[model samples]
Target: MPVTEIESESQFTELTKNDATKLIVLYFHTPWAQPCQTMNQIFKTVADSKASDNSISFLSINADELSEISELFEVSAVPYIILIRNSVILKELSGADPKEFINSLNQFSSSSSTSTSHNGPTPLATATATKPQTTSQPEEESEDAVQERLKKLTTAAPIMLFMKGSPSSPQCGFSRQLVAILREHQVRFGFFDILKDDSVRQGLKKFSDWPTFPQLYVNGEFQGGLDIVKESIEEDDQFFEKALQAAA
Candidate 1:
């Protein structure tokens, strides 16, 4: 299959949801990351080599350009690859290890072929299964459940910024300043609005041991709030890049 560059969120959602028989390989990246550029070539090579295989599809998505999709998949780092079938994530790989990535793909392909040969291919389903199915929908999450979700949300992007609103339209002055600083430094980040989810807002305070909004997380670790971010930037000129590299 040809490598498809996902230009929009709707297109990405459509492709992932509609294709159940084919293993959808989603490559999440950003143009700024040099490692991502290198991985792009590797990903394309793999896609071309497996072109004859009808059970696989390749897609590349710029994480910054499609923040919503990145957040949906909880993409924490660049050069991230995720394999999904029937809208269910089968595997997720981070960083730019071409050898490991190719091995993973080969293993998945082989397993899929074996499964299909034995059981036959299943028909594609329309609904996406982002979360595990339950017998009945719950009205609210437990404390522990909320904590777990907060942890996941914080690591949803390489540079996760939990704020009152989005980077474009901050709902508070602190969040506005933080967004401005990030933009000034040309930081590619993902954000969550605490106001939108009361559970996350309250839970993250205890989870990270930090009681504040506009919190920032690097990799899967909590970095701190806006003030600490500013201090780090002032202390290290390449703070953002260094953090991402260290995470990668």
Candidate 2:
């Protein structure tokens, strides 16, 4: 079995973000890190064997050489393997335990094999909740008509996100960051692009009585936008820690 070296950040992106099927097992660390060396051997051995069988795609990256890539994966510690398919990360693991790593793959395979077919991976929002309208966009429709349409979209799911843009292409940094946070947590969500609906756009402003886009609602409960979410993360680092723990 041969090991494919993930040299540049673009190559790394091509490995995980694009291939999707090519499971990335990045080994992020500096040369001086003692535990990193041990983990690299463990990963290399597993990846070499697994790659031959086409069971998994194996690649290693030195965190020092690709700081940006590490940042994308949010690698806080060394000797870690982040398993990803497409843009969705299946899991992450730390340390140098061959048996546990193999067990993880087995479990993942078992679950994925039985998993129901989905159009694509799920998103973070599960519902929608908000309704507001105005007369300025007369060319479109009446405020009441627009409000009714918005109400339908808001209630499309039990949890929904009304923001600057949709899931694939966010219109603002806050929305983009917000989307990333939800995906990293593996939360399935729905989003309404206010940019597409002027009525809903103004309607949400008055409906929530809160002036802002990128607003999040879980189970129909309003969760504030980016700054608030970041503040929440800052208050409890455990926010990311817990999600990473589950990934591991």
Every model's Cα RMSD, please? 14.2, 13.8
Off by over 4 Å in 2: 109-248
User: What TM-score do all the candidates reach, one by one?
Assistant: 0.50, 0.43
Q: What is the lDDT of candidate 1?
A: 0.74
Please write out the lDDT profile of model 2 over residues 135-233, one tens digit for every residue. Answer: 234566776886676666655554467877555545698887887887766555566667766767788777666798888655444557778877877
Error of 1 at 62 (Å): 0.3
Error of 2 at 207 (Å): 46
Model 1, position 44, has a per-residue lDDT of 93
